[model samples]
Target: MKIKSAEFARGVTGNDYSTQDNLPQIAFLGRSNAGKSSVINSLTGRKNLVHSSKTPGKTIEANFFCINNLFYLLDFPGYGFAMRGVQERNKMVKRIFWYLEFTNARPKVIFLIIDAKVGLTDLDLEMLEIIKQNNHKVVIVANKVDKLPQTKRKDKILSIVSQAKGLEVLEYSAKTHEGKENIFKIIEDLVK
Candidate 1:
């Protein structure tokens, strides 16, 4: 599935426009600086589709992007940013949970992005547990694989897969666009 046109729809902080349209939603989530925005930009074939920052916790709200006018790709705020205040972090996490649990715009599938070099952190594992409890279909995306040495890439992916249990974990590199087609295929299948 090719994305012919992609544009920013809106930035949602609550249960408002996200559910108003009733379009299928695909959520992108990860720890701070795990390259969620970069993966989205790579998948869309748009360099600046979603602003990526070097600083962690820059994406404070859930930004929605319309793809091919068929569905919305929701880029959520990254979790586990130590620099942020406790109150702010709690609020952000609450909002994410609210969207996942109470909102009508529950995503068709969630792409849980993680830094391949770092493997799965404690925060990612916690988020995964909550997501599973909510009964959401989730795919673990091991992003930034290009940074790993070729010899170690396979091993790293294997480690993540084993740690993820039965969940499907795709190898990805936003910089090199590796695994972009596989991700597109997953989205196509889920949206259909």
Candidate 2:
């Protein structure tokens, strides 16, 4: 998608995200350090549009970025981090679940990001269940494919497919900009 204008809209916390106007939103969901912000920056074609931190679980709020002034790209707070206090982590997880299950502003699609090298984990499976329970269409984004060897790409994708029971998976490399356009096409088709 051509990013004519990508700007920060707002950050949401708790159950009162109703301040946001209705717009087609595409949410990126993942564990801490899974590169949600990096993927957003790459998709928007702006290097620093979304601030990326070297630390894990830095994104505390549900961030909204308006893309092309037509739709929103929500960077959900990363979950499953050990660094955060148990209370804090539970709060974040609850917020994510609430947003996905209870919010009126359902996203057009939820892109569940998985680290290509690390593969899927229990938390990822839990997230998949949450999205599925909400009856939301989800697309798996196998991120950091550039870190894996060329020969392992297909196997990695196949493994995910096997586990997901035929879920749509797209590979992406925020560092190399690989498979970025495919994600854009999916978003464009959904938002249309």
Model 2: per-residue Cα lDDT over 46-154, one tens digit each: 9998888899988888999998878999998899986788888888889999988998888889999888887788999998898999999999888999998879888
Candidate 2 at residue 98, lDDT? 92
Which residue window of length 10 is worst by lDDT in model 1?
13-22
Error of model 1, residue 177, in angstroms:
0.4
Which 10 consecutive positions of candidate 2 have the poorest summed lDDT? 14-23
- Candidate 2: pairs in clash: none
What global local distance difference test value does model 2 have? 0.88
lDDT of 1 by residue, 156-177 (tens): 8899999999999999999999
After superposing candidate 1 on the true structure, give the runs of residues whose Cα lies further than 4 Å from its correct spot.
Answer: none
Candidate 1 overall lDDT versus native: 0.90
